[model samples]
Structures are given as C-alpha cells and as structure tokens.
Target: MTSTDSRTKEDVSSRTKKVPPPMYKVILHNDDYTTMEFVVEILVNVFGKSLEKATQMMLNIHNKGKEICGIYPRQIAETKVETVHNLASNKGFPLKSTMEKE
Candidate 1:
C-alpha cells in the first residue's frame, strides 16, 4: 500500500480502539442525626464492605464529615449515590451521598 493509505489505516484503527471509561468516586456525607451504626450498615449492604472495613469507613465519615465509599464508572457512581439517598430517606435519616470525577 502507498504511505498515505497505510497512515489512514493506522488512524482508523486507533480511532476504533476502546479506551477505558472515566471513573468517579462515590462519597458519603455525614450528618449530625445519622447514626454511626446506620452508616456502617449502608457501607456493608450497599457497597459490599466487610463489617470491619465498614466500621472503619463509618468512623472516617464521622470524623471527616465525608469519605469516599468506592470508585466506579460515572453511571455506577451516580446510581450508587442515588441508592444511598433513597434508602436513607426511606428510613427517615438525612444521610447524603455524592459523586466526583476521578
């Protein structure tokens, strides 16, 4: 093939190659009224953290006001944030969650 044709093929292949999706951090926000036990439960049930790890994360949220629960693709992070809000609200707690690009 001509040099020009080869260069075009290379460009096309590069364009077609899959690149990894951008990631986001799911963060939990602590509130005065949200019990520490509930925070731990959310971490364990929602994020799949072990009880020990969940307890550690809960403490971090308690002390720091917010902490990242996990990193995931943008959509998953957003879904997780929404789920946390829904569950917390349903239970009459003011727990909050948010996502940030990573």
Candidate 2:
C-alpha cells in the first residue's frame, strides 16, 4: 500500500475509541423460604465462591436481608442473577436475585 494510504488508515485507527463494557452489580435478596444452606450452595456453585466466602455471604444476606453478591460486566451479571433465580425457582424456593448498574 502507498505510504499516504497507510498513514491515513493508521490515523483513523488511532482516532477510533472502543466503548468500555458497562458495569453491573448482582444482588441477592434474602427470603424466609430459602434456606441458608441453599444460598451458600448457589453462591459456591454458580458464582464460584469458596465455601467460606459463600458462608460469609450467606450470613450477610441473612443478617442484612440483602447483599450485593458480586460486580461484573452488565450482561454477565444479569445472566448470573437470572441463572440463580431460575435455579431457585426450579427447586421450589422463593429466592430472588437482581442486577443493576454499578
């Protein structure tokens, strides 16, 4: 390619900016019907949290009645919350989860 064309292409590439991924917070709401054991299991299995971390989070939810489970990119956070909700519902529990912008 010509030097002029190459320089023009490089300039355009340098000027173009990539849009950053949106941030989201995944939250878990406490419920009487869902046992703490189930919450811990979900945290461990779905969120890849360690057993101790999952227990701590479960306790937080129990005492605080709600807690932010984790932060992630928008789509991923939403998906995680949705997966947890569905799993809880399928297991006949009233557990609820949601995601919002960080």
Candidate 3:
C-alpha cells in the first residue's frame, strides 16, 4: 500500500487504543433495617434485574453481607446507585448503595 495509506491506518489504530472503555462498579451494602423485599425491589427497578435475578442478588447481600450489584460505565453505575439510594430514602428504608472504579 501507499505510505499515506499505511500512516492513516496506524493513526486509526492508535486512536482506538487511546479510547478505552470506562469502568465502574455498583455495590450494595448490608444493613439491618433494609428489608430483603426492598432490596430485591431496588435491584429490579433500578438495575433492571429480573425477579429471579433480584432475589438472588438480595440473597447474596444478605448471606455474604455485601454484594456487587452490577458493573457498568461510570455514569451508568453512578446513576443506578443514586436512583436506588433516593428510592430507599424516600421509602424510609436505610438501604445504601454506592459506586466505585472496577
């Protein structure tokens, strides 16, 4: 190929390598006052988890004392955590959620 074509290809490849996928983690913390039902509901509503999946996640947090709710890009994970936390607080539940780099 021409030198110009090869240079263009190299530039494209370098650009792709520089743009990495952002990472985030959504975490649910265990708490005494947050009901299992509420936790499951938050999982379902906020995280778009199915009923079965929500149940399993709630159980994991209960049994293991904490669980990673989901992994998403930074904005998504932050939004999920904020939404869950708002719902819980509004409902008078002490359920806590957080996000961190994965």
Give the number of the best model, judged by TM-score: 1
Local distance difference test values of all predictions, in order: 0.94, 0.91, 0.88
Number of backbone collisions per candidate, in order?
A: 0, 0, 0
lDDT per residue (tens digit) for residues 1-102 in model 2: 576656776688877968788889899999989999999999999899999999999999999989888899988997898899899989999999988898
Candidate 1: RMSD to truth:
2.4
lDDT of 3 at 66: 85
What tens-digit string does per-residue lDDT give for candidate 1 at 1-102?
577656777798998999999999999998999999999999999999999999999999999999999999988998899999999999999999999999
Give me the runs in candidate 2 sitting further than 4 Å from their true place.
1-14
- RMSD (CA, angstroms), candidate 3: 3.1
lDDT of 2 at 34: 97
Q: Candidate 2 clash total?
A: 0
Q: List model 3 lDDT by residue over 46-93, tens digit each.
A: 888999999998999999988898899998888888898889999999
Best by lDDT: 1
